[model samples]
Target: MITVKAPGKLYIAGEYAVVESGFPAIIVALDQFVTATISPSDTFGSIVSKQYQENSIFWRRQGDEMVFDNRDNPFHYILSAISLTENYARETGQALGVYHLGINSELDSADGKKYGLGSSAAVTVATVKALCQFYHLPMDKSKLFKLAAIAHLSVQGNGSLGDIAASVYGGWIAYHSFDRQWLHLQRQQHSLTELLAMDWPDLKIELLTPPADLRLIIGWTGSPASTSHLVDKVAMVKAKQRGEYQTFLQDSKACLKRMVQGFRNGDLATIQTELRQNRQLLQGLGDFSHVTIETPILKKMIQIAETAGAAAKTSGAGGGDCGIVLIDRAIDSTQLLKQWAHEGIQRLNLNVHTVNDDVISKA
Candidate 1:
């Protein structure tokens, strides 16, 4: 059996702006993960996952659209991963074999509640990693990320692939998105193998060593938010306010620069200050789009953390999900977690997952 694990991620900063090419975001991979295990089968293959529900699926991409082999199957990310990996395998002249692939995740609650931990991206990365091992394909971190990003894009069709980057690299890293528009055009003229080998325009990934004194804390609001749904809402209104939106993007870029610098310099105060600025920028974005980026509960979550002398902000799209806080190690977070619990918030115990290697191949 070949097994691979991809860690879930939370955005530290640069949410909406990261979607555009060349904008930077800081993201961390959580200890929670989605694991994919595969083994060769004799007659046929099956893909099964016990997440949300137990099921399996097969699919193919028709140009930019995903065409499900089984219309009732909901696991588009896995199917897309299978399709793309097999394509890459054939392109590399590997003999494909029937395999049974199993996926299990720790990114959700035991009773099946999502915590907005970027499960889709994690699963996609996991599946791709597993298949690469299954085929004995020697893949570097860059190729794995590019392959997973293509599969992920074929399904949901939007967002910064920053979560994919975090899953691929692990630990804390700075990411800039590649232009999907450029990829779209290049797909018309290039082969899958060639595409993976080629340099991506505007895409950047750099590992960062954050301040050792800083500690990460996550608080869940107990209400899940649809990342795709919220991103759609923001995109719809973004065009109507072009000038203001441009300003928001610019400010976001500037804020991310300072925060990244703080990480490099081991300055917790600079990081905290910039995080607060990022929250305000996201709030202004929500105001113009009339999309509630921060709900009452999320706002309360941030306020509580701020009062404790830590910096806090909504993690993802933020209609209702998890909020992240960075506090100095000297400051006790016990009272902070207690206050959140009193307000019905669940404090999640997650650490920054550090990867010894981008992918582990074990049999």
Candidate 2:
């Protein structure tokens, strides 16, 4: 049996802007992860995920495709991962055998609420690694990131793939979005195997070492966000208002630069200033796009963090999900937690997964 683990992620800054080409976002891999275990199966392959439900999906190879026994399955990501990995193997002249797969996650609430911790990306990365191990395919982090990205984009047509990168290579990362327009056009003409084989030198993914004194607190808003819906809304706005969108992109780029510099120099004031400015920028985006990017509850949480002399902002395409707070070591964590609890924000006790740590481990 082979087991693989992938961590979920949080975007510190550059959320909507990172969707544009050449814009960079700072993301951190959380300690929480999704684990995939693969072992040999006699008749056919099966997948069981506790996070999805109590159902098991049994599937087998049908010509070149993986046909699951159930059609209306929620675990489309697992199927996509298997299908794409199979295609990759065949294209690279590798053979694969049947295996039973089990996926478990620690990135969810005890009562089954998702923390908006990029669970889908974590699972997709874990599945790709497990499939690679099952088929004895030699894959480094970069290759694994590409393969997992192919599977993710197959299921969900749009994303920056920052979560996928964070999952494959655990740590604080500065990432630039890939050329989605080019990828979309290429997908129409090429297969996933062909796309993965191509080189994408323009996609920048750099691992960063954050300041030791930097402290982070993750607070869940008890509401789930549809990232696709938000991304599409933003995309429509960009299509109609290209100049305005460019302004947002430029402003976000400047903010991200300052934030990165702040981290490097241990300048808490610069980091805090950028975080608040970026939050205001996202709020402006919500107003411009007519989509509520930041909800009232998320705003209140940020306010609470700010009152305590910390910088807070929504992590992702936030209608309502998790908000991140960055503070210095001098701040009172206990007092902050009490205030957040009063505001109905659930604090998630998670730490950053650093680059020195292993992303995939034997379970």
Candidate 3:
């Protein structure tokens, strides 16, 4: 049996600006992720999922055209991965058969089907890695990353592809986009992994779970706002006036340079400043926050978070699924968490992790 686990990611900086400015964006592999286990089987190809119970067991034959069981289809991405697997096997002349594959995700926490933190990407990476291992496909990291990217794009239609890259590559990533193409650049002048593994500085972070008393308020805009669509729109929006856009681009580039330096220097204050400024620039692009996070409820929540002295921003796709809030040192995160609960906004205490340190036990 072969197993693979991949991490989720959070974009700390360069959200919308990364599109227009082609600026470098920083991301961290979160502790949350999806796990896949594949076992060789001759009886039949079976699939089980913890997330979907009833439809978990699917029996099929070798080279049989796999059909998705809509009764418990998590998302179209799963089907895309399956199709890719078949195509890859046929193209590479590998024997195609039913491998008893079990797929599931162990997230830090989730509010049902909330669309934040790259769950789809996690599944895609896990599936791709599992298949690669099962077939013993000698693909390099770049090739594996491309396969994952293709599967992700099949579903999202448009995404930065940074999430998949970070999950597969397992490290802090600097992402860029050009001519409608996404680029994942290597910029680990410093690695949190090497630092943590070596136990250089005992990085101390207080990951506080929001008190159970508070309800995290999440809303779906019911609008399918494509990340690429929003990003491309920003490009078109900024093109009408070159000067302002160029200035924003230059500021973003400078901000990214400083942000990287801050990470290396362990200067949280500078990082926070850059992130705050990046958020402002994203807002200027007008496609920064997703609809759900932009609603009055979310606006009030951010205002409340600020009033309670917390650093907050929309997580993931922003038109909104989740928000990450950092409480002030002097403030009790739990106390503020309770207050937000009183206001009907949900809070989550999540742990941060570095690539190749937390998950990615094996490729």
Candidate 4:
């Protein structure tokens, strides 16, 4: 049996802006992970996830695709990974054997709510890693990232793939968006295997080492946010109002640049200022797009974090999910956490996952 794990990710800055080509976003991989265990199966292949559903899903390859017994499938990301990897092996003159897979995730709430910690991307990466390891395929972080991105984009249609990259590499990273327009057009003409063999030099990825003095606090908003819906809302607004959208993009790009510089130089003041400005810009985007990017709970949490001398803002697509708080080591987080709990926010105990270390461990 082979087991693989991949960490979830949080966006530090450049949320909506990274959807376009050439814009950069900062994301950090969290210690919490989605784990996949793969072992040989004689009769048939099955995917078991008690957290996601009541029963296991039985699947088999029918011709060139994986077919599930039931129509309502919750393991879409895993299926995509398996199908793509199988095709990749075949295209590269290799063969694969069937396996029984069990997936378990630590990225969900106690009561089963998703933490919006890029669970889909994590699972896809983990599945790909496990399958490749099972087959002894030569896979590195870069190749793994590309495979995961292809699977995720196949399932979600549109994404920056920042989360996918973070899961594969595992650490603080500054990632430029891929040319989704080109990828989408190519997908219509070629298969997944053909796409994987092609080189994409336009995508830029850089590793960042944050200062040791930097402190991070994550607070969950209890409600799960739909990134797809929020992204669609923004896309609609961009289509209707090109000038306003361009302005938002420009400001976001500037903010991201400053934040990246702050991380590189360990400038706390610059980081704080950019975070506040970025929050306001996100709120403005919410207003222009007619989507509630910042909820009342998130606003209250930010206010409380700032009152405690920490810079706070909503992470990812907002609406709900988690908010990030940056602080120095001098400030006590006891009162802040108490106030957040009083306001019904759950403080998540998480740390950054680094690429130099092994993110996956055998059971």
* Candidate ordering by TM-score (highest first): 1, 4, 2, 3
Q: In model 2, which regions exceed 4 Å deviation?
A: 54-74, 185-197, 355-363
Candidate 3 lDDT tens digits, 187-219: 124232221123111111111222222222222
Per-residue accuracy of model 4 over 122-209 as CA lDDT, tens digit each = 9899998888777767676777888888888887776699999899888899998889888878878987666776776468888887
Overall lDDT per candidate, in order of appearance: 0.90, 0.83, 0.58, 0.85
Q: How do the predictions measure up, each by TM-score?
A: 0.94, 0.90, 0.69, 0.91
lDDT of 2: 0.83
Say which prediction, candidate 1 or candidate 3, comes out ahead on TM-score.
1
lDDT of 1 at 129: 95
Evaluated at residue 63, the lDDT of candidate 1 is 100
lDDT of 2 by residue, 122-234 (tens): 88888989988777676777778888887887777777889999998788888988887787788789876677777774688888777776799999999987787789789
Candidate 4: where are CA atoms >4 Å away?
Answer: 54-74, 188-194, 357-363
Listed per model in order, the count of residue pairs whose N, CA or C atoms clash below 3 Å is 0, 0, 10, 0
Report the lDDT tens digits of candidate 1 across residue range 131-183: 99998777888999999999988887889999999999999999999999999
Worst 10 residues of 4 by lDDT: 354-363
Error of 4 at 151 (Å): 0.6
